[model samples]
Target: MIFTIAHKEFRSLFSAPSTWLILGVLQFIFAWFFLARLDAYLQVQTQLAMVANAPGATVSVVAPLFGTLALVMMMLIPLFTMRLLAEERRNQTLALLLAAPISSGQIVLGKFLSMVIFNICIIACSTIMLSILGLGTRLDFGLLLTNALGLLLLTACYTVLGLYLSALTKQPIVAAMSAIALSFGMWLIDVGSSDSGSAMRALSPSAHAQSLNSGFIFSTDLLFFALFIGAFLFLTIRRVNNNRLYA
Candidate 1:
């Protein structure tokens, strides 16, 4: 049942021309950044060769690219998630979903799964572009894998957060803006905090992702993402159930 809803939502997304347009623009930006980074790495290759333990192509190019993509998706995902439930509400179709035989958990999880699957495709595409460098240079498959894992978790965090916000309002634009504002605020908390061990900094998903971005995977970071995603998903499910009860 969850997969059924996910398939319907996934098909609905591709059916929209706007999804294709967003993908085109995102790919163009990613490619431009990738080439620019590759060129810079080539220019510094000789200098790096002389320095002991210098970062390789993976560190020099792929890491920054992943970081940039993470930031970009932090803002971009809300645009896609805005319509996940808010648009249905606005179009007066949410009532049908709420009244369906499926549980509220299924509805929320299904929608969340659809968005996560979509983002996995985006991440896979970006990783494939970065993999092209493997032909000319040795790449850190470990770092690449870890970074991909981090970004996937981060984007999933964004999806669930946006899903909850979408359930709170009937206006898709409002949901998008709220998600962006909240996400940016959390990012600011991570950036502005001076103490590395501060509890406030620990609240930001970006902070946890940065740990992975550095090619080190810690269980704590993984726990943070798991908790963050789970909390929001629970909230979204609760919200949907309330809507069902009222409707």
Candidate 2:
């Protein structure tokens, strides 16, 4: 049943013209950044050869691209999630969903799963551009894999928060704005923290995402993401379930 809902939601995304427009803009932005980074790396190749143990293509180009994608995804996810529940409620379709045989948890999970799979496709496309570098020079497969994993986790984290916010209101634009405000506020915590182990840094998903982007995966970072996603999903389920009382 969850898979059925996910499939329907995935198809619905593509049925909207805005989804294609956003994807096209995303591709253009990512391409511009990738080319700029590659050119910069090329310009410094001569100087880098003179310095022993200098950073290579993987360090200069690929990792930063992942980091850039992380930032871009942070900004884009709210738009995707804003309509998940808010639009349903606004259009008066949520009541039908709420009264269905399926549980609230399944509906939430299915929607989340659709978003995750859509995001993975976007991430995979960005990764292909990075992979082109491998044709001419040796690339760090392990590092790329780790960064990809990190992005997936980061996307999941963002989606869950956006989902929770979407559940709070019937106005999709308001939900999008609030989600972006909250996500950006948390990101600011990372930027403001001077100490690596500060409480503010620890609480920010952006901080842990940077750690994973460095290709060094710690148990602590994994734990943070796990707890973050679990907490939000739990909250979303509870929020949706509450609708039953008034339905």
Q: Give candidate 1's TM-score.
A: 0.98
Cα distance off (Å), candidate 2, residue 85: 0.5
Q: Give, for candidate 1, the lowest lDDT window spanning 10 residues.
A: 238-247
The TM-score that candidate 2 achieves is 0.98
Each candidate's number of clashing pairs is 0, 0
Question: What's the lDDT for residue 147 in model 2?
Answer: 92
Model 2: residue 210 alpha-carbon error in angstroms? 1.4
lDDT of 2 by residue, 1-247 (tens): 8998899989999999999999999989999999999999999999999998998899889999998988899999999999999998899998888878999999999999999999999999998888999999999988888999999999999999999999989999999999899888898898888898898789999899887788899999999999999999999989999888765
Model 1 scores a C-alpha lDDT of: 0.94
What ranges in model 2 sit over 4 Å off?
none
Best by lDDT: 1
